[model samples]
Target: MKHALLGASKAAQWINCPPSARLQESVPEDPSEYAEEGTVAHALAEIKLRRRLTLCDSKQRKALDAEYEKIKTNPFYGPEMEQAVQEYVELVEIRVMAAKARSSDAVVLLEEHLDYSDWVEEGFGTGDVVLIADGVLEVIDLKYGKGVPVSAYNNPQPRLYGLGAWAGYNYLYSIDEVYMTIIQPRLDSVSTDIMPIADLLEWAESVVKPAAVLAFAGEGDYCAGDHCRWCKVKGNCRARADENMKALAYEFKDPALMDLEEIGSILFITEQLKVWAKDVEDYASGQAMKGNPIPQWKLVEGRSNRSISDKDAAIAALRATELGTDKFLKPEELLGIGELEKRLGKKEFAALLGTWIVKPPGKPTLAPETDTRPAMNSVENDFANTDMED
Candidate 1:
């Protein structure tokens, strides 16, 4: 399926930074194996749900074999992949049962195609599963990626799905409440946000509609923030560069002269500046790999560790030389403390090893006073404590 220019997955980015929608048009999307795997996972989940609901048409049934075969071609398809899809399917089944129990007339929609073009031009998306009851509508979205823990609270993608679902089923059902659920089984996270229809529509009119208009028209400023994570133009976004540059251009002043507010603002921008710097470096490296060299920069072989050309052959040669096993092999060591903690489970590990655990004081670092972690004791305080101990 083709992705819309302003897809729901990117709603957070374009909604906040409207110009990004048009800016991304010129930059081609970077293809990733991860994305391919995610698509396969979604397809498998859709197949499972459709089979359970028996919602597929004859044409869809005919295409199922090809779709299943296509999934097999994906390197990511395996027992683990099937297990994860099964977990998501089970959750959807539970939701479906609950919704039907509330109202026998309730309907469950699988991979439902929805259009919200009335609110935003060309705005449409597919909902993984949508449940509509007498006065409630639920949109359940499965997130296959575990890099970011997605939450439904104030999440734009799921909310947009909810909006699309309500638009499609509003005439049939009196949906007073809309529920958006994100199932991220890899992270063991299931987040749901309940929104009143009145509030969602109000927000759409006030914030989303206005932004969508500007974005579609290509007439808005590019404001950079966390939302730039997946924007196609992020590699060379001038607005992002300008924002990061401003952080670097801060004038030097005496530490005593800086006010608390000024220091706090600097701290906030510094972390963003660090991330932007890394993004720039990574983008340049990727371009360099395609024979587009950055000025005064060229790739060089990175440091590598030594390894046997063929482990078995090397072992055979060592044995032929009459080398003892003890001479050729290293002694096994206990697993790392972190690995043990994970294996034993958090509570069990903590209970068993609590007495042995000692967290050394972290090195003093600068941060905004507003940071939640308590400030490290002052040098004077540390010395005072030492003196008292003496």
Candidate 2:
């Protein structure tokens, strides 16, 4: 049976550590502001290019700048940066078209979602641009993020996108091979990679299908770790602590004792812990919802005693004295506790201590308890004696 699995990036991690699935599953909706900003930028870029291509004059360029000025005050990004990026993208598109980079006789498919069933049980993806350039199918994805620059080389997402494009075009046009490319307009870099249809299909069949089956089974085979910091079910997992401890131990162990077999075993156990941790986290979350006590702990906020920076006060006090010139304590120098205690008298120092309040750590549980056990023997005897007197 085919089930909706985590995307390519997450699926790759799952092969190494199943606990990472929690992160993949708990992805929240994109921030509205970010979505709006992206839309505005893309729309502006498209408009500018279409205008430049149609008008083909310096006058049109000035008009484009004026249009950009209207939205200059927008908080998403400064107008200058936005305009620069738009211009860069326009230039790249022009260059690619000028060189006839795409095949003259190649089929063109733009902004289409393609599905491939030949590889995995039910594989589907979409490409930003697809064209049969030089008689070979090419799939391209445009990325905006600078933090993680999209690389076409050994990139699974783009490869999957290529597969989808290949599947889509192969039906209508006889395609022999597929090529993938990622253009980062912001970085002014273009990366290209090739994937053979046979290899791509093999990965889907041998790797992706089995992983999808395991994920869909809903078995207690997931684990938790630092990745749980972003997991939705972290609060429910008891195995989180165990997994965290195990990960720590593995990290701290001596490298000298690790053989190939030992390393393999460690990897396997780590994956298992990830699954178990997720299960525990899920179970605990359910318990909490039912008003049951879930075994969990948090760092107790405790106050540590610290000396106040009384440099100004000390300087002022010393300056007030008519000692030859108004020579005061240097701002750079600090008095030790012992020196301060000796200078201020024991009684005065004790009085100063009273001015400081030490806040102790609060007790853990905030819930009120219902008394279910029998009264203490002393309390029972007192109640009995009071009843006799009455």
Candidate 3:
């Protein structure tokens, strides 16, 4: 799909950075397998949703089925994806039914184009699902990846989509509020946030419009933060390098021991350091590949290991050896809880072996207080452990 320079998907980035949208256009990103898998999952979810909602006529249904069959032929498509997408479809269906209850002419549109150009110049994006009723306009985005948990509260992406939805449908319905949602089936998360129409427009004018004007004209200061993770030019951006250098200066703070404030500061930029270091390495490698090597750096073969050319043939030869198959084979092991769940599915797995399943406490780790997970009580845990021992 063709994307506008100021797309809703990257609203969080450009709105925050203000200068990254045009900077990103210079360095094109290579497509990954994960993105392809997400596309397939979205297609599957859309098909199931259209069928359940009876949004398709007979001819359209047949075409949709054909497209679904074609998607099944892809290596990424599987029952696990189907189950996850089914959950998404059912969730959407529930909302659609609710919308119907309130408004007989409720609209449920999938993969619909949205125009937020009023606030952002030529800014548009595709919404995964859009629900329009008399009072509320809802925009739901499907995130197939499980790497990061996305929230709807004050999230710029869905908010922009909500703006576009409201702009396109306000005449058809008396929309008073906007409902923004994000559904990450892989993470089993459904985040919803409500904002009044007045508030939504207020944000658009005060925040989105000013930043978008700067972004579209490529005339703003370069700011670096979490949003830089999505910027294509991050590896070589001088602003990011300068920020990282400034952030790294804290390392010079007492080497012997650290105070809580110093430790917190270090922790804040730890991930940023790692991401910057890796991106610089990749950038250097790409430059070297193009015969633009660094002055003192030279490329050489990195460490590698040999592997069997044909695993099946190698295994057969190993089995014929006098050393016996024991040398090559290990004892069979049971699948992990997650793998088993995938094979049996959540419902069936729970029904058959829910009693046997147990969840152990995860190792304690440091995180920002903004994290929604409850903080671990180390003192209470130790007391409980002592009591149990006695």
Candidate 4:
């Protein structure tokens, strides 16, 4: 799909740093396998959604099945994608059922083009599922990636989608409220944020519109923060580099002299600073590859490992050296539980190997408070005193 210049999905970045939208305009987009996989996943989800929600005739069913078979042939598609997309479709079905309960005449729409051009300069986004009822309009988006668990609460993208949804459908329905939901089946995440139509409109007027005006014109101050993660210019953005560099401007005291509070603040800064370092490195490497070498640095082959080019011939020569089969090959081992589960599926694998498998405690690791997992019990909770369950 061709995205708008002020696309809703990138609202967070442009809203915060209005100038970034145009700054990234000329930088080519990097092809991502994860994104390709997500596209395939959404295609599968849509087919299932149409089949289950719409009353399909026999011919329609065959068509949908054929569509699904074609999707299965994609390299990124598999049983895992099939199951994840099916779960996402089921979640949408549940929401549709609830919408129908609210209004018997409720209408469900799939892949609807929602335009919020009133608040933004040609801003638009696709709502994966839109349910229009008497008093409410719901926009549900399917997040096919499992990278970062997405929440709809006060989230800019879905809120923009909500704005767009209400904009497109307000005349048809007496919508006083909008519900924006993001379903990430692979990550087992479902989040919904409810906003009254008036409040949503107010946000658009106050927060989104002003920033969008500047963004569309490619004017406004450059700012940087977490939203830089997906920016095409993140690797070379001076604003981001300056922001991360400010962490080093902190006056250093002896580690023993710095209080815990101060140390904790530094931890937060270093986390983002690390990502900045990697981005700079990657961008520089790419430049060097294109013969635009960075100052004082040139590309050089680093390392290699030798391996047999003809495994069969090598094995034949090895056998001629009086090495018997028993000497050459090791005993076969069962596949790991994760691989088995992927191959045989969850229920079947569980039924066959449930008794034989036991999960030990997972190693403890530092994570942000926003992680949904329960906190370790505090016997000092210094993390050293806790055992984490898988």
lDDT of 4 by residue, 1-390 (tens): 688899988999999999999988888888999988888888888898998888899999999999988997898877677777878888898899998998898899998898999999989888899998879888999998878878999899999888888888777778899899999987889999999999999999999999999999999999998889889988899988888888789887776688977877888788888899999999999989988989998899989999989989987988889778888766798888767876775556778899989888777766677877887765456555444531
Residue-wise C-alpha lDDT for candidate 3, range 267-290, written one tens digit per residue: 878878999999888888988988
Predictions in order: lDDT: 0.85, 0.57, 0.88, 0.87
Which parts of model 4 are misplaced by more than 4 Å? 253-257, 345-357, 368-390
Residue 369 alpha-carbon offset, candidate 3, angstroms: 3.0
Error of 3 at 41 (Å): 1.2
- For 1-390, candidate 1 gives per-residue lDDT tens digits of 687877899999889999899888877778898798788899999988877766677898878867777786777786556767878899999999999899998899888887877778899999999999879999999998878878999998988888888888898889999999999875778999999999999988888899999899888889988899888777778999987887778776777688877777887877887777788888999999989999999999999999888999988888888779889977998787766754564456668888988999888998766766987888999999999999
Best by lDDT: 3
Q: Residue 34 lDDT in model 4?
A: 93
Listed per candidate, the RMSD to the true structure in angstroms reads 5.1, 22.0, 2.8, 3.6
TM-score of each model, in listed order? 0.80, 0.49, 0.90, 0.91
The CA lDDT at 175 in model 4 is 88
With a 3 Å backbone cut-off (N, CA, C), the pairs that clash in candidate 4 are: none
| Per-residue accuracy of model 2 over 1-390 as CA lDDT, tens digit each | 122344443444443345445444654432456457655655555445545433446787777677667656566555334644564456546544732555545454444566654553345555556666554667766665444456788776776677767766666766666677777664667887876667766766776566555554433256554345434455454456666566646553566677776676676666656766576756665566667765573233459887658877866776677764325433476566555544554446557864663567554432212434443445578899999999
TM-score of model 4 (CA atoms): 0.91
